[model samples]
Target: MKKYGFGVDIGGTTCKIGLFETTGDLAEKWEIPTDTSEEGKNILSDIAASLRGKMAERNIGKDEVEGIGIGLPGPVQPDGSVLLCVNLGWKEKNIPKEMGDLMDGIQVKAENDANVAALGEMWQGGGKGCKSIVMVTLGTGVGGGIIVDGKIVSGAHGAGGEIGHITVNPHESVPCNCGRKGCLEQYCSATGIARLAQEALAQDHEVSVLDKAAGISAKTVFDAYKEQDKLAGQIVEKFARILGKGLSNIACVADPEVFVIGGGVSKAGEVLIQAVNQYYREAAFPSCVHTRFALASLGNDAGMYGCVKLVLE
Candidate 1:
């Protein structure tokens, strides 16, 4: 293996760049703003310039570097071509070719941002020492990455791990951002949890702490649940049931060794794991019922780690 590599994780607002030892230790990290202006035409150029500057500053030659791995916030084909990336305003872009060319023919690999995060977790975080894991990210919306046999299952069309859009309530009227109704995101995401709280509050029920809370969020509900608030308990029960069932279905398909939970709502800590696990255990297939559940430990850096691992492979 080469002595060093670079991991570039591109987001809508910023691109996180990390210089790393091939042994998996991060050497240095920095960020560059993503210039989405002009349809993001300058995004790659800016990243390339920053990378070159870093190399010069460290006095490192390209010969000592393994490659650069990029995590993009959109579907990535097996050949590293992206048809569309609304977040980056990219269309018909071939990431490896473009970035590799910019870097003087150095090796480059790219994958969906969520997929890389899952790979990162599998490599050095929650799922470390495991060969397979399903990472569920419960932020404003639900996002997921599936790693099986130590590789990302991006699937045909690069949409394999989109667990959030899975329809949990087919008969519901509300549509997801993807324009489907009753997606798992509708009830299992942070926004979903808060929405559930709002629906509960609109009804006649027992006096609860949430009634007087400044704002209702997943944290508020979990906090109330910790305090044994009956209404919060009900809301949490519903949220957990839906998420657990969703994961149970995933287990039947992917049969990963573990489910690594991450993103904003996962901040609830052990309470979130226990709550979801309780229902997952009840509904999971017999053989998959024992699949482990753990919180994601890497937080924001997971994508960069995964990107770096991409080239290591």
Candidate 2:
């Protein structure tokens, strides 16, 4: 068996790379600026060069390495082809073939960034010790990854875990970035939460601290909620209701053993978890009602760990 591998998570700003032992330990990690110039043509070559340098510095042979696993911020088909990654300026391409060729016969696997993060959490973070798990990332937008029996259910079209796009409201006039209306992302994401706060404050002259705040943000809302401010509590409850219901809907389909919440919004801590869980319980199927909820522990590194797991798998 190969003793080492590389995990690469490509983002619009930076590409995070990790060297890992097959035993699941990350031995080294680093980052490189994403050169998205010329439609991201330099991105793969840059990663290949960096990996070669690392291997040479460590006196490691290709035979000693398992392969490279990459998580891209886009939809990755089951065959390791990426349809498009707008952030990376990537069009349709086979990532595995491209990266593998540049890496001199080493194997390569590719997956969507969110799914890989879920895999990472299940393997070594919040969902560790669980065979089935759902990971929800509440960042600028909401992202999700579903894992069943230790493998990602990436779906036939690579859209398996797009939980954020689920329609939560039919009357919403504002369309989502996906050109859809009333997506869960419009209610549960950090930006969405802030937007909600703004709308709530606008609807009525609510006597709340948020009105006097210089800026409104998801963090501000959570902070205000912590202070037991009434208006903030209302906004948070609305956010929690939508998120919890969205998760319950996911549970009905995937029936995962655990739900791992991560991303910027999750930093709100136990309060967020408890609030979401309360709604999840109320909405979840009886059999799934007891599914555990956990905050993601790996943070940004979750993708890297998950990439390694992909190669190891």
Candidate 3:
């Protein structure tokens, strides 16, 4: 095995790069803007250039490095072909081939960004010490990654672990970004929480502190809930109920040992976890009721760590 490897997380705006020992210690990390102009023609070249410069500066020989493991913002086949990445202006392309050609003698592996994040958590973050885990990321939209026996289940068509798209409210009138209605994302994401708060505030003229605020956000709702605001408490309960039920559904299928929650909304801390756990326990099947819950520890570095994990695997 090589002594070191590179973990590259390609996001829509910036690509986060990390150097790591094959044993999983991150030696260095950095980021560079993702130039999406010209249909992202220069993105790969830019990454290759930056990596070459870094290697030269460190006097690191190519033989000492395992390979570059990358996380893409879209579905990726085992062969490292990306089906599409709207955010990066990418279409069907073989990532490993192109990247390997750019960096002679260096190998490349790629996986979906969300799945890589789950692997990252499983390796050294919230899911550490566990062989199976389901990670739910509650950002603008909910994202999920499933890991079992320390391996990612990318699924056929590379759409496995799309937990957010699960239908939680089949009756919802508005369509989701995926052109479907009632996805779990519509009710459990950060934007979903804010939307719930807005709907709640508009449905009733009840006296509340939220009405005086400039805007309603997930943080605003959580802060109010923490302060013991009655309306906020109700809103949080609803959010927790929906999220917990969604997690319960996932548990029924994946049966992971732990459910790691991450993303911006997780900053609400244990209160959020406790609330969600409470609902999860109530809804989970008896056989899975004891499933543990945890907050993701790696934060934004998770994807990069998972990227390295791919090469190590």
Give the top-scoring candidate (TM-score). Answer: 1
Q: Can you list the residue pairs that collide in candidate 1?
A: none
What are the clashing pairs of model 2? none
lDDT of 3 by residue, 1-313 (tens): 9899999999999999999999889999999999989888899999999988888999998898899999999888889887778999988889999999998969899999999999999999999999899999999999999999999989987778898999999789989989999998988899999999998898865677888889899999999999888889889999999999989988889999999999999999999999999999999999999999999999999999999999897
Better of 1 and 2 by lDDT: 1
List clashing residue pairs in candidate 3: none
The digit string of per-residue lDDT tens for model 1 on 1-313 reads 9899999999999999999999989999999999998889999889999999999999989998999999999999998779999999998998899999999998999999999999999998999999999999999999999999999999987888999999999898878899989999999899999999999999998999999999999999999999999999999999999999999999989999999999999999999999999999999999999999999999999999999999998
TM-score of 1: 0.97
lDDT of 2 by residue, 25-124 (tens): 8999999999999999999999999999999999999999998999998888888988788999999999999998999889999999999999999999
Clashes of each: 0, 0, 0
Each model's lDDT comes to 0.94, 0.94, 0.93
| Residue 244, candidate 3: C-alpha displacement in angstroms | 0.7
Q: Which portions of model 3 miss their true places by more than 4 Å?
A: none
- Candidate 2: how many backbone clashes? 0
Sort every candidate by TM-score, greatest first: 1, 3, 2
